[model samples]
Target: MSFLELSLTLHARQQERVELALEDLGALSITLRDADADTPDERAIFEPGVGELPLWNEIVLDALFDSAADRSGLVHALHELVPGLAPDRFTFREVEDRDWTRAWIDRFKPMSFGARLWIYPSTVAPGADDADKIIVHLDPGLAFGTGTHPTTALCLEWLDATDLEGRTVIDYGCGSGVLAVAALKLGALRVIGVDNDPQAIEASRVNAERNGVADRIDLHLPEDFPRRRENILVANILAGPLADLAPLFADCVEPGGLLALSGILQGQEGELLVRYAQWFDDLAVAVREDWVRISGRRRG
Candidate 1:
């Protein structure tokens, strides 16, 4: 079904208040984007952490409502609720429904993470020179971790460079199982992928099978996951959960095993370093754009 979408350009500071106002106004769904990003390559990432929203200086908030929503009344109410905003900032239109998943995947070009590893959408063709690189073919569908986002990119690069030979690994918050599968492809003896969502488990399974490493990987939900420790563990989730799961994560890695943590924003690493430092040593930081990855060896 088609829906009425109302887009508003405003200062970043007003986003939260406006988002609440939109929800109060009966918007079915809302999205925030960088208003000044006119280029196709620019993306909006909304990974929330402690007091973090990761937004540009100006934001374009889009609220979607049923086709029957009263446009004039809605605009009038927004003007009254959020005063001092220029009227020209408001734009409303009808948007046709689409298979969003297909649309997104169609645009996912082949990308290289580190020197030896590359990720290609099953729909796209890769370059001739990629014959020598370790390539991962992905049909991510509704699951996350395609190596496009910085969080997943950070993790994939770590997996690419690390020596996984004769080692077992754990991919916490496995998502599409990209990391678990990557670890296997990179010569890890075995990999255990853990995530809460059944869809994610299935996605990881499919990707692992596609890479011919299905037999070397195990997928599990958080509660069903075994208490066994491994030589390496990588988690690409938000900082809040990362901090809370530090103790569990430390236990998941054997003494002298390695740990890699992603999905953290730049300023938030200090808190994570302090939390993981309890059981981990020599925690090193890696930054890509606004994201950060923390790596260290569990204390022996």
Candidate 2:
């Protein structure tokens, strides 16, 4: 069946009320986007820290409805739900249904990071030469980190270059367990994966099993995670949380252990270096596109 997509640009302040109204009016799904996306005025709406909610100042709210639904009725309802909503601002079009799963699978072909590391969907088979390569089998899921994002790629490349043989690794904020599995595949003795989101833990478990690293990686929620010194610690999370957990992260690494951090914008390196310098030495930064990765050694 086809669908009707109704969209309207609204101030960020009006999102909650308008979303509720759309749900009440039989919207099958509602999604928000930045109205200035792809423009010079585009903004970044990053993941908020615990108990914080951050959204774009101006948002494009899109609600999908059944094709037979009354468009005029939706507009009138929205007007009542949000006073002063402009009628001309409402836009909608019909969207045809297709195999979204296959489409996504088609787009996510095998991706390589560094020299020996590769990430591919389970549906795809590795090439003959890949017998010598370290492969990560991951299917897209609700959780993030498929090694496609620059932040995740940087961490994966660092793991590839590091000698993980017989080393204990900590993958803090382990989204989808990509880093944990990669470390294991690269010969780490043990790996611990921790994330605040339960879905992330589940995704990590599934990905680890897919990559046959489930036996080597232990996945847990942040509160349930055990603290310990490791030979290496990698966190592909935002710079803000990285700085906030500086002491805790420092404590997780053994003296002279390696620390690899990503999910930072280019200009944010200095602040992070200063934050981590208290416990780490030989700090260095690498850049990919607009993102930055910082690596260091735990001070002895």
Candidate 3:
């Protein structure tokens, strides 16, 4: 189904505010992109928020026009959602997705994580498999993660290299339950994927079953974080969220257990390390492309 594509020109600080405002108005998925493609470091991201409302429907267009007439409403809402943003600094426009959103996965391919592990959706898994490799099958859904992104890849690779045989692992922001599944594939005795989003929990469960590890990897809500400490904790969420979740990540891992994190920009490494330092000792950074994956062990 075609979706209404909305675009907004927002200042650095105003980005989240605008996105939240749009979300309140019915956006399902959003991407932040630079206004100018040639300028990669221009302090902007082309954010796309998708809604189920079809763009071809004139009724949806009419509502957009009506909403645009009172842009101040969104502007005011932004100021409330995010502080210190001058509403006038933001501009909004609406476009038709015209199938552009669905194409985001066009480039997706079977990804091999670690040295010998491969993950493929049942429909996408290559017909021929190397006898030596461990292959996992998964299907795409609306969940937040896929191993295709560097952030997810780093975490997957780490889980691959770690000796998880019979270890208990927790995936803090289990997107498609990919990392947890990976851990199970590596021989973790038990794994669980946790997320606040119900969709993520559902997707993770289904993906776990698809990979033949549903029984091994349990799904839980973020609030229902298991009381037992895990042998390993892996969180591949954004830098800010990871920092906020540092204490929880530390608490979840058993003493001497490792915590692996991704979804951080290169420059944010020092700050992240400092935040995690209070809880985790001997933090180390792993670089993949321009992204940094922070991994460390919890202090007793």
Instruction: Point out where model 1 deviates above 4 Å.
Output: 1-97, 126-128
Question: Per-model C-alpha lDDT, please?
Answer: 0.79, 0.79, 0.67
Candidate 3 ranges beyond 4 A from true positions = 1-106
RMSD of each: 9.9, 11.6, 9.2
Model 1, range 149-226, lDDT digits (tens) per residue?
676788999999999998999999887788888888888999999987676788788888888999999889999999
| Cα lDDT, model 2, residue 288 | 78
Minimal lDDT window, size 10, model 3: 54-63
Question: TM-scores for all candidates?
Answer: 0.71, 0.70, 0.69
- Cα lDDT of model 3 overall? 0.67
**Poorly placed runs, candidate 2 (over 4 Å):** 1-99
- Screening candidate 2 with a backbone cut-off below 3 angstroms (N, C-alpha, C), the clashing residue pairs are none
Top-down TM-score ranking: 1, 2, 3
Error of 2 at 283 (Å): 0.3
Displacement of residue 128 (Cα, Å) in model 1 is 4.5
Cα lDDT tens digits, model 3, 139-241, are: 4445656665567778888888889988998888886788888888889999878887676788788888877888887888977867678888888766778
TM-score of model number 3: 0.69
